[model samples]
Target: MFRTENALILREVRFKESDRILTALTADAGKMTLAAHGALSKHSRIAAATQQLTYAELTLFEKNGRYTVREGVTKEGFPGLRQDLGKLALGSYFAECLEQYAGEDQPEPELMQLGLNSLYALSEGLGSCEKIKAAFELRLMTLEGYAPAEESCPVCGRGDIREPVFLPEEGQTVCRACRKAGRSLPLTENALAAMRHILHAPAKKLLAFRLTEEEQSLLSAVAESWLLHCSDRNFPTLAYYRNLKL
Candidate 1:
């Protein structure tokens, strides 16, 4: 059987000497692993489309419950991301996040769209890497049904919140009174507004927010801790991105 779909190449690993294994996020089928023969060769047509972060239309042949890539035509490779190490690492981190949340044969179009939009923002330099990463993490958590409550402090129910503190493990924002309970980070009003925008902004307007350097750092801290707490695991690409001075 043959099937065709639009997919983004999240990862590519060499199979034998010439063939490659592709980890793709398909618009119609979510995540899938497809084998591409002769993909390592310089003359291979599918080479460009098989590279990580390549959004392409793929044709695959299936037999015995396995899918093999027959052809791939590239759509968007976000070439600008490749021009900078930081952007490339961030893009890789996005791919890894998608790989973790997406499941085989399950359609998650919103997640796919979010990933594509984030790559576009990185490619176009829409925002600073820290802002982009924080926004992506917060919004992604919301999409995965782990959004942090922002209405009031979950502990004190104080609606007029001042100097909010976020508890990552609890996925809640608390008032200043609750900060001493354990390891918690300050979530400034600006940072809280940023998270709120990420959780509620329209799809096309997701990357439109602006923030000061201080607010950006606060948001990054809260976002990183929240994502880490929710996932309960660290991603290698994220670790590398964090280590970079950029």
Candidate 2:
């Protein structure tokens, strides 16, 4: 059987000296690994189609639970991404999320749209990279059914959050009244509200979003804390982006 779809080459590796193994995040299929014959050769047609960060229509030859990518052509170059390190880092971060969280052959239409929209925003150097990144993380949390309780503290149902701290392992938010004395996550109300807004807003408007510098710093802290608590791994790309001067 043969399948075709708009896909991004998420990862690639050399195989057998002449062939390559490509892992793609597809619009329809969440993720798939395909064989690309001679992708490294001098006159390889598959090379262009399978370039990392290149969005393209991919044709795959499939049988016995595996796929070999046969042909492809570009749909969008996202040229702006290559021009800025910050944008590239953001792109890489999102791609990492796709690889780590999204399951294979389990279509996530919402995530696909999120990826497309985010890529566009990154390509254009949209003014709110921090906002966009925060929104994306919050949306991803929502998709996983772990969205923070924005209307009120997840534990005490308090309308006012004085010092809200999110406990990712427990997947809930705690308010000042309910906060344990030694809990290290002392997040500000500004951060919590900003995260809540991003989680609740429509995806199309995520990139156009803005946050005050104070709110931005707080939001970043909360987001970094949440993601670290959830994934329990250091995200080097994110660290690099944070250090980057605007």
Q: Which candidate ranks first by TM-score, i.e. highest? A: 1
List TM-scores for all candidates, in order: 0.96, 0.85
Report the lDDT of model 2 for residue 33.
86
**For candidate 2, what is the total of clashing residue pairs?**
0
Considering summed lDDT, which 10 consecutive residues are worst modelled in model 2?
179-188
Q: Go through the candidates in order and give the C-alpha RMSD of each one to the true structure.
A: 1.2, 2.7
Cα lDDT of model 1 by residue, 1-246, tens digit: 998989989998988889989899987788999999998998999888888899999889999989888899999989999999989999999999999988888897988999999998899988888888888888899999999988887667788677888887777888887665778888788778778889999988887787899989988999989988988898999989878854
**Global lDDT of each model?**
0.87, 0.74
- For model 2, residues 1-246, the per-residue Cα lDDT tens digits are 888888877667888988888777876788888888998999998788887777889888889998988898888778898898888888878777766677787886777777777777778867567766777777776777767666766666777865777665565677767866554455577677667667877877664445677777667666656666677777766777767845
Q: What is candidate 1's TM-score against the reference?
A: 0.96
